[model samples]
Target: MEHVVLTVQSQNQLQQALQQLDSSWLNLPSGRVLAQVYSRNLESGWLLSVSAELRAKLPNITVVGCSAMGIVSAGSDWNNATVVSLLRFDKSSFVATLLQSSPDDEYLDGRNMAAELAIKQRDLQGVLLLSNPTKLATTRLLRGMSDELVNLPIFGGLAGDFSQKLSTSVMLDQALSDAGSVIVAFYGEALRIKTFNYLGWTPFGEGMTVTSTQGDVVKTIDNIAAYDLYNYFIGIEKTGFFSSAMEFPLMANHGGKLVARVPIAVGEAHELVFLAQLEPGDTVQFGYGDVNSILSDLSFARHDLISFGPEAILVFSCCCRQSFLQDDPRAEIQPFEDVAAVAGFFTYGEIDTANVPRDVLNATIVSVGFSEEPAPAAEEDDWLITERAEMKMSRNLNRLQRLMCFISRMTEKLNAKNQELTRLAQLDSLTGVLNRRAFEEQLAQEFQHCRMISAPLSLLKIDLDGFKQLNEDFGHAIGDQLLCNLVDIVNRCVRHTDGFARYESDCFMLLLPQLHYGEALVIAERIRAGVAQSLTIKGIPELPKVTCSIGVAKFHDEQDTLDALLSRVDFAISRAKSAGRNCVKGE
Candidate 1:
């Protein structure tokens, strides 16, 4: 339940840090040691040697660590610094497992490791993971663990080589490698785990719909090349896209929370490659991180840890955050020390298992707090400085959000108005069905398609039985209502691809592609019955019944010109009226 942090500048200084670990209070016979090592400019062998030497000195201590580009401990940022965090649980047992995996099959390796550790699944309370970011798919590895260990809370980060050379190393029990992963699963009843993952990225601009994706590479966004979309919206040169895009990554709605997806590298084919997968049809928006929002979220994280009353807190912060807040990355970790002892390293992507089984995050800060005894609730005013800063930041963000929302609403209204105008141009003013011009244009297009594919195409010409008489009896108002009512009925009874239009004052047209003469006759009969059954005057509910007579005709490439086909259907309609007022006749 207690921890000692050892910060060293060199190997000789590391010996001094070891003296701090030998305090008498931690020298119990049953005491177990957990140490996380962070070093810079050091070879993997020397790091392993340090771990081995620690094991030789402490006898029963377990060691695990990774190469961190930046390390945080005791309220300060340490760039190219080495830190050794020592923890000894006073009342609980510790079980450690170090897993080695090939970069190609890390998913299977995760499943196997979970299966091997399944025996202690029930006893597991928390998990700490460190892995090589370049060699493994961060999301797939976490998914494998989530599938097997559904109830355990997992938190950790990807290892970072300070030199940015992809030489990250993960060490467990004297073994270290830059290509595999290491997991430290904690087993005890006294372990209390709570994690907070916060992304302060503001979403702006038009949202892009994901149209095509292959695994982790998003190929086309909105059916355009992903690279082109980024270049157009971001307006950055191809060489600077990666660095500039980091300021505004893509944010998606995953399980009702915004998760940022960082594009690591671009492919030669112009794919925006990410460490996570985005499914087609998911809408993503470009997001920008601001200092006020970032600091506000950090303050909230510290407050959350205070409320949880944890004895120690471990951070798995995104390296991009460091780059964004380059002058003062320590602002994130400094406040946490006010609540508990703090230690963590920068990661390429952070894993947050506090919510559902779906919590792999980027451009976020993931804080995990550990506690054995619950601390009494502290007054809200205890952290007043941070609270005021948060309040001020929230107000500013709220105002910005409100203004942005207003502009967005106005933009949406304008877009909706434009859509309505376009719709009106193609629709009849009275009946709300396709106008003569639109219907004829659609007919020509459908005819060309049918000719190309040799598909069946049918047309129907419908005339009201007594539209002129109805208008004379009840005036044009009632006549127009009857026409609209009949159009509604026919529309409901036909396929969406089938076209319906108000061809004239008393005549309607229907285009049925992929249908023959017999099929068209059946549809025309259905429409006749529907109109006869549901017809009524809008205000006068039971005034009069409205009916229609329909004539059907099938298209023939050799015998039917577009004009000839229309004339034939009109002739069929005349015949239907001659045979009976309410009937369907075909030619």
Candidate 2:
């Protein structure tokens, strides 16, 4: 009997709760068929305390899992509790593959991965897989898995923080190593897999066909490198060479799979980065995720509840997606509740049958809702009410909601405008850093105050590593996101009281107070770390990662005026850059 597939989760008291489950569930008939118990992580490794007991009993039955947002136990405010789900399968009815390993393998390798399922020789009912989807081209992984396995009906999702998918998957008990995965594949009879294809994103602009290209990394489209084509559409200069285009594309479920055609990104330089995911020869359409549209899609589904609902569902949503209109998921829960009684955490990526029947893609959310009993017929009460009386009663509430949303939008716009104005006044607009005037004012203010107080103050100067080469390689947009991300990182590491002003194009200065000379070295190291990290901006690829070097100097009342401090830091900074792209040194 396929009973309820309940995934109980909590982020509190993880150890105690697991003990209670071990004693109670280990012997229960519900778990005897195969109870795979797993604990959650606190963004780190799960404790051996939680694992030692479970591993003792089910030595052969492997459970590949990880934490749910935080360390947890059941009923621990959801965010503080641990999560454990029981899959009671009729061992006779289904051939399940529990692939577990260390950093190297979860339970099985690719060869065993294909063989384990093939042995089931069970009619390929469906593939319910879950793994870490970070950085890995899951689409490519499964394409290979299915090509060998042949026509496996795929369902399920990337099992990680769907809400925050930036981190890679953390399979339970697996070594916390990068580029590792824990794969779970299930095959059996008595299971009917029905797939519902939905990209949910709608296309916006005109369609552009690929005039030329290669594999996933497109070389050219319409006789131009994909990047050049995008530059033309968005008005980016081609002074530097580029690989791809600013791909603004909508997602579609054509031929029973999800594909992002013509992916696009808005770079920090106000230019576009092409995030092309489709083949170069394929035609592309521009699209984006509209929060309102997604909400509307949910409402529309309610009307056609006859389509894919009425049964309980497990929703696997893309982790990259931060719900827009219903950003406050709690407020919007009622809407989804009305649909499938959905109780699915966000997914790292979703696996859906792709272009071919049963081929899976890398980044997607898969929803699997099972009905314990036959669904009841729709009734009059179930029909949504457009009640005039209730409508009148809720008028004030509706008005207030609209007003609040309007105010929020206005606040965002105002902030954007203020940032622009500040940048224009204080920065070299072309370089997008503090201008010469702001720099002078800041330095003067810091110098005078620190001089009077006899406090320790430090100065820093920075220059991009190989900036000219940046201009020679990919164009200016790449240079722009790099700078923006760099500044953002520096801001994150610096104190609010500290000041950062760009003195020239590709040159920035940081002023730190209330610190001694050696302390300045520590701050300099942090600045170096912040600027040297790479972040992928949406809609662009082939953006060379960013690197920078910092030179630090301390203010001495005797030898240091504002100009002297700047010159020393500037010189030290120049030396740092010359040594290597990412370093911090002090004088």
Candidate 3:
């Protein structure tokens, strides 16, 4: 495989670049040739003229082009210019197609396009796609394509426009489209394709739940207007929110992976509009670009590209990343030139076909490497030096990264400590059981649940028959130990679903959901027997045998309140104590 990357500023430059290609290789019937044009200029007439000139010069060349926010080439990135990449393959072939589509019918359009491409080549290896992000649903379109092209690699990006008009265009052969897609289907035994993406944005602050949404517009997050979230946290106002929010996008878990969503506009109701759909109940965190992390990831990606040894690399990087990286926008793209020729554009959103079902990503850089040769075995020193010495970090970036890490770790520790405190507050310190207040809260929840489902619920009020006398005789320390031992024995006799609590000094309560009076009575009898046999005061040869009086009461009709149920259980316990010291009774 042979390829050339050139930056063209005018029609004459494009013609000159095309003239540099070998005419013999262009005319070879068994060879495949592809020309990808990424232009920052959105003039329709100028683009059309350039397209016409290319087709006139090379009639057999497959041309796939799109409008770009910025064009990228080997070791450099350009704005308000065009980059052309010419690829000639000796053992591989490809078919290119253009399909007009409507936003309302994007899925059908995608399926139709994929179906046509699948029939074009029998040994389809991969696909290259370019579409208008503003005029179509790219995510749904990718899903439709995935339905037809299962496990097939598709890599490209949405056409980008930096002008206020926001009109993006794509070109195929001699035709240009503003509301359609262009696809190139590559097929051959010798062609090999690999894709990789790097997102170095670090998520900060607490995750907020998406409370309400309408299509791609998020109305509220954490029950407040979405705009308020950005305003309060990131200090971004509705005015120029799109540009200001570029540095900080929302990172959410989509399809089991953390995908970034960049806000394109703020609505009149203060809702944030994104390029992709977001559902309510999804958790999102504000993410900011970290220079250190980005460079670190670039080091690993550079190593992988070197090992793969591709002939050419195509980049589809997010425009937001360009804005975040500022002066050094090509830092991520320059490293690829060491292994292969590189050319692509900064996109509005990137299409990553590396994952099954594919994903439309924002604030990410997607690299697609093409090779006709197998990778060679690695040398011992090949992995030793991955990062370049020239990639130095600024003092401000280092301090910012250190501060971010410190804040993140502190927030996590504080959240963990808060959760532990909450759990401790609900438990009894001595017995490790639910305290009276916590038990009542749980019992109220269970009561309401039983009422809703019309299920049976039983409560057992247990009292140690001689707790007061034992406390005075054995001292309070031994009495406390005895209570702890008795709780362990009773816990063994009950199901995990049952709620056990220390209701008072010598009284305890057990809540049994979905259980009737008979089941509660059986459990109460088992607890009485277990405590009698297992509990014994230490350092005393023979003290009064530990025993408990249990009163089990089943919930009555709809009119029965929690207090009324407790009253009945207390009466039952009074009867048990009057009859005998150690016994079980039910009401």
Off by over 4 Å in 1: 25-31, 39-46, 49-57, 74-77, 290-300, 356-359, 375-587
Candidate 1, after superposition: displacement of residue 511 in Å? 17
Candidate lDDT (C-alpha), each: 0.77, 0.51, 0.83
- Per-residue error for 379 in candidate 1, Å, reads 9.5
Per-residue alpha-carbon lDDT of candidate 2 for residues 169-267, written as tens digits (9 for 90 to 100): 544443442344445455444443444434445444445666554333455655556665555665545443221221234344446444654322333
List model 1 lDDT by residue over 1-587, tens digit each: 88777766667777766766546534455326688887664654777777876776677778888888677766343655777877777766666666666665767777677766768656677777787777767677878887777777778988876565566788887887777777877766767778887887767666789999987899988998888877888785677565666666888898888888877667788888876678899899887775556666777777677778888788888777766666565667777776778888777778877664645678888888887775567885765644522322234455654555675567668768877888899999999889999999999999888887788899999898888988897889888878888888888889998889999898999999999888888889999998888888656864677788999888887445788788889888988999977999887
Error of 1 at 192 (Å): 1.2
Highest lDDT model number: 3
- Pairs that clash in candidate 1: none
TM-score of 3: 0.80
Tens digits of per-residue lDDT for model 3 on 239-269?
Answer: 7777789779999998788889898888888
Measured with C-alpha atoms, the lDDT of residue 147 in candidate 3 is: 76
- Between candidates 1 and 3, the TM-score winner: 3
How does candidate 2 score on lDDT? 0.51
